[model samples]
Target: MTASRTTSAPSVDRLAPWGFAAFVEANTHDTAYRPPVVDGPVGPTIVRGGRELVNFASISFLDLERHLPVRRYFAEGALAHGLSTSGSRMTQGICRPHHVLEQTIARHTGKERAISFATGLLANIGFVHAMSSAAHFDAGIEVRNRDTVFVVDRDVHWSIWKGLEGLGYGRNVHAFRHNDVTDLARILGRDRSRKTVVIAESLYSADGTMGPIVEILDACDRHGAISMIDDANGFMVYGPENRPYAREAAAIRERADFVMVSLSKAVGLEGGAIAGPAAAVDAFELLSGTSMFTAAIQPPTAYAAERTIDVLAGTPEIVDDYLAHAARLRRQMHEAGTPTLPTESYMLSVPIGNDAVALQMREWFVEDGYLVPVFSYPAVARNQALLRLFPHAGHTEEQLDGFLRTLATYRQRLGL
Candidate 1:
């Protein structure tokens, strides 16, 4: 009846379709399930499919809602300020709270000054863009014959890479293996005759590994290069007595030259800042194209950051509780013999092998009453996936235990 139809499939539209149909055919299917929803950062959340799950994927390490002071400040201040900063710092946007927050950040991080941005990516990108603009001229002229080489960790964030790619600084960018100080040294030695600028993160977001700040600083000093450390993942998590960066900061005063950090992680707020020597800060403010073009950070977020710092610095109880919970969770994971990365802090990476296993584990755990994010290639190693769980101050011991039990169930069921 259909005339024995044997028609070739329609050739996919190359320009309009953009290969989305092909991609969907390959990656997506009707069987795929969606992640659940949450009421807030706290545990005992309501998922999308009418199920309740304990949330552990939140970056809200400090349960902000429990902090009455932070809530009160935001409530009263956000209303009075009426939300946005309305403009960039260079234009009509500069406000009193912005300056106050910058000062607070500078003092907290032991740097001369800080320039706040909307997000961490922007801060890192903006810093690189700004620094390159300022430093390029110096390299081309004053530095004399010496080339300007940009040294970056292989795993440096996409934003940092983007900044480098956009710059016209020749093909002098060097990539060193992740956290390999020796490789970095070898690269620097090759460029001993030129001026270099190093860019790296303090705490790697994916694996929870810290960069060797002390060694990197030493290398920068030897090579006569300016170093920029994105402390976005470190900041309040590490204090002077416990962490190397804090100790190094105290010793050298202005050792790293440029430091960038985000307020979103441990600070429990939304903003990023560049902290550095007063001169570098000045140079960034004056010459940075990003700073010149983009609107300054909103006043409310700046105020929120200021309040967050005060809360974190003043209340050791919160940090202590968070650390204790994390340690307990770590011990439980170890006992369960789950393949979690060795971590000394709140960020925990539960390695789940390949993408399929990671996705299966995430789905199965959600069904058993827990929420953990599954991250795969392009963010981490190809085929190497993980369930990144962040322990927050708000979750109780019982809740954490529930999460562990659910994880164990999934771990066994999936034969992980």
Candidate 2:
């Protein structure tokens, strides 16, 4: 009939435009999306349903929000500065505080310069696109399509994948096995001639595992690749001495490279930054989408971020408390037969194996006065779900005891 002469347009339903909705609905059943309201701070707590519960889901590891001085600074900054920047950085948004924050981060991280973005995702996306789009051709020598390879860790954050995808060079992208330096070496060896960019995170969110940054950086150097790491979760925890990335920042600058981190996590603020050589920072200024399109984060956020950095630098007690709490929590969970990711980081994940068990455990824990969520496939390993928790600096030993006791009760009920 079509061959004879009839022409028919495709139906809107045939396009499957709402496929994402159905997919989300089907996969989101076993995950509890709890939005607990924070009443006040008392060492890892939130007032839920008229009761204060031990909160193990907050990302403020250094207790920026709970710190009275920091809160006061933020409030005063908000009063002094307006709510929004109201214009893009390239236009009128580059204020004194934004530059101050950048300089503070640069000084703290031992980098030549630092460029800030509105959010973590924007920072990742902007970094990748900026590297790709910057004018590297100075002598009529065009950078070919497949000449630059984007080497990524298999378990990198989705925002990174989105950034590479947005670059539209899927075929040029290669993935190394997660934290497998051998495979990374193999991939880099294969592309010895091309300019490669190794993309990895300092600490993976899904498994709460640390990347072999020193090893990866060595591999990157061996293959003539640029080592670009996302230090979103590791920045505060791994200050200068403890972190390979931070310790190697000067060397990275010597070799002409960088690493990006989010201010929202341990910084307890709103934004991200790429710290490295001034050349790359200049390139970011010229080509980063966040710089070109989005307005800088509010002056108040910048002020808060700067203050957070000041606290991290000035006081070691906060970090010490956080580390001690994480160690105790891990020990308690392991003793309760709920093993966490193989690291000493504050982000803890208690594996439950089954989604139903995970959901039950999460709900039971929350009901029994512990606020932790069961992170599922999208956020972590599929089919191996776990209850994700964040023990902050404000958390006390008694709070830890309460959480452990509640988890023990739920573990008994579920026979876990």
Candidate 3:
């Protein structure tokens, strides 16, 4: 072999920047345009950069984060158990509190068992990864990675897609139109040989719309497909009896083969859970890569979540009051001539259509001493930007009144 004429030194060519990273880097030079540094959530408002702004971005729908009892439970648990369990459930992350929380979730949802993950995103990704590959784990058929197909709603939460990221048959994934039972049936009908799993969110938080859950589940059953639901937005609010109070019932919780819940939302705490048949949930305990390799939730959060579930269980009237309050505010929005998407829950979006206009709307909110979340590209389709707002039960009368006035002013000036 001819002695390989090797170059002594490695070439030092700078790597080309990626699209979004380069875009973000170029834009960050504008100091005023960076993300707000929030101090923390206080009641219905947030303290940002030393100023308190009326907050519409918070998902603490029950306003339980400010509840003294919840706080006390969290504090007490932290003091007693220290902070983290410091290991994945496969290792030492397992703890008594985790078991209790899992039991609570299973009982509440009427599922056979439940699994807890560090976050809802993790829970979803892991559940999808593990459950889709599971053999007879309530799918009533054996499925390996190569034999399975995932049929997701077009607007299913991003984490579900992430879960299917590296699977062998991932390219086989098909998306049905959002909330379209006919479209879902067509897709489910196309392939019966492969094991199929249908995925959706019972509440599409971004659009402030409830999914056609009962219809979707009915279709899934008709086509011999299993269903997985992300109940992140509907939890603690949506239930059997016309939940989110008369808007729709979350029949998914009762009907889905699998369900994911984010404690970070209605519970106003940290952590996520996946509940299903005991065999399925147990298989994911080891098969769920996210939960197996990641540290379990902190003890304090588990304590807080448990307490919150109890408190919310006793107070179904709060859910009713919130929808009624949100309905009243939504009416005021119509009177203000602000163009809004048809929303069925306390969450609503003002369709802005253009990215720049939505960003400008955010600046206006900042200037008006309020903070609201806007969805643009990457969050939604291009030119389909919107200012998604939450009407919290905890917002004061003055705050609500001021928010409505600001929206009216913006509508008059920009016609958004």
Number of the predicted model whose TM-score against the real structure is largest: 3
Best by lDDT: 3
lDDT of 3 by residue, 243-297 (tens): 5433334466567888899998888888999999999788788788788887888
Residue-level lDDT of model 1, residues 1-416, one tens digit each, is 55786888666664445866665567652324332343433433535456666777667577766764666777666776757777666667467777888899888777888877778778887777665563335544321222457899998888788878845443567889999999999988888545579987877887877788788889898888888888777777776464434554443335777788888888877888888888767667656556767766666767777888877888777776777777778888999887678657567888887887787776677667776777777688888888888876777778877887778877787777
| Clashing residue pairs, backbone N/CA/C < 3 A, model 1 | 88-295, 88-296
> Whole-model Cα lDDT per candidate?
0.73, 0.75, 0.79
Question: Which order, best to worst by TM-score?
Answer: 3, 1, 2
Q: Estimate each model's TM-score.
A: 0.85, 0.85, 0.89
Stretches of candidate 1 off by over 4 Å are 1-17, 29-51, 134-147, 168-170, 240-254
For model 2, residues 284-382, the per-residue Cα lDDT tens digits are 876777777877778888887888888877876676666776777788888877767777666787777887687767767766777786777666667
Q: Using TM-score as the measure, name the better of candidate 1 and candidate 2.
A: 1
